[model samples]
Target: MTTKLPAAVRDRALQIAHHEMGHYVMARALGFVTGGVTLTVTMDLRHQGGACITLVRPISSIEAMKEHLEARMMVLLAGAMAQTFPSKPSAAKRVDKPKATAILKGEQGAEQDYAKIRELQHLLRNIAYPDTDPVSCERIAAQLKAMTDRVWDRTQKIVEDQAEAIAELAGALVDGMVIVEQWGRAADTYEVMYTGPMLERLRAVQAIPSLCVWTDSCGDAVQHWK
Candidate 1:
């Protein structure tokens, strides 16, 4: 198929790619095992979407659990933060937090992501405070919101810092050379494994210097899952 396409189509594809990469990049940085990232956009607009599947290892300690939850939230928030990228490269560093936060608060495409974050938040809250008393529950809710906001801020900063990396990966996707979506797969099915050279290229585009440290910390958790 010819790579040439309308400008609108290309823009949408890049946007979707960036959104999924936001999650994929953050997840990898946090040592979460990613199944892969997929982007599908056909003439049928109803089926246009992308995903980055991540797997967090089971934790033996409460501390690990908390860290994992916070990491997951950051990963989730990264998607929206990426989508809000300014069209001008020079403005990437100056991304307005208020506008980006608005997108995260209730972006149309991010409902599912926000929902997932909420569920994770709920889990974290329950783990942190098991008490069912009304007063304790209210206080815990406030504390949890604070924690969530902190994670959101951290995620936004990471996205801002990695703006170039995210754009590079998205461009690779738009070029249809490195990572191309499987048009033959069913629209609803979104499972792709980024292995071999493809995975290497993806890593090359996004330099996560801390990946080693993160992996070392959670490497044991992976073995436990198997």
Candidate 2:
């Protein structure tokens, strides 16, 4: 009564699901609230990509802003880092930093994430040094590279430590998508899969309180865990 998806189609969808779950898991683990996660599948079912809706609170102080930016950088980097894991949990047990970094660097899916990271770094530099005069492009490039390296190392560590949780979440995502056709939107051009089950799994994994409330403000999601 139903057509079976081709192996390539299913594998592409699975990869997108894993990538989005990576972001969602890291956001919740870092005490950020997510509106939801989405997996978009074309009608032809050949191309797929996903998005994770992460929310942050507004910050008033420079110190708060710096911390917020750094945390967000970690969240952005987490998606690519998580994608480095083997689809099989058994093979994923080993944490290979070089492999993970290589994947992060080479992943075209992560280009936008890396762009956002650079944008945040620029904001961080300007806000932290508002009075400083403009430096040569070379110096600025070097400084940003140093900042990226520092944050990348930190994000890598977090991803490594959370490998078990990430694997669990990614596995759930791949399993959940088998019924994705049931959730296709009226638009028909693209299908958006629901993330309620994924969120529940994340909350359970992190033992986060069920006191979540929806708001554009950041206090509850950022401070409640602290």
Q: Compose the digit string of candidate 1's lDDT tens values, residues 133-222.
A: 656866877877887777776777677777887777666665662224558764332222343247556654446534322233555444
Off by over 4 Å in 1: 43-47, 56-58, 93-106, 135-138, 177-197, 202-206, 211-226
Model 2 alpha-carbon drift over 4 Å, by segment: 1-6, 41-45, 93-107, 179-192, 201-204, 208-226
The whole-model C-alpha lDDT of candidate 1 against the native structure comes to: 0.63
Please estimate how well model 2 matches the true structure, expressed as its whole-model Cα lDDT.
Answer: 0.62
Give the top-scoring candidate (TM-score).
1
lDDT, candidates in the order shown: 0.63, 0.62
How many backbone clashes does every candidate have?
Answer: 0, 1
Question: Model 1 RMSD to the real structure?
Answer: 6.5
Candidate 2 residue pairs that clash: 57-218
lDDT of 2 by residue, 2-101 (tens): 2343565555655566667667766766667675566655546644555555565777876767777877887787777777666655774444557556
TM for candidate 2 is 0.72
Backbone steric clashes in candidate 1, count? 0
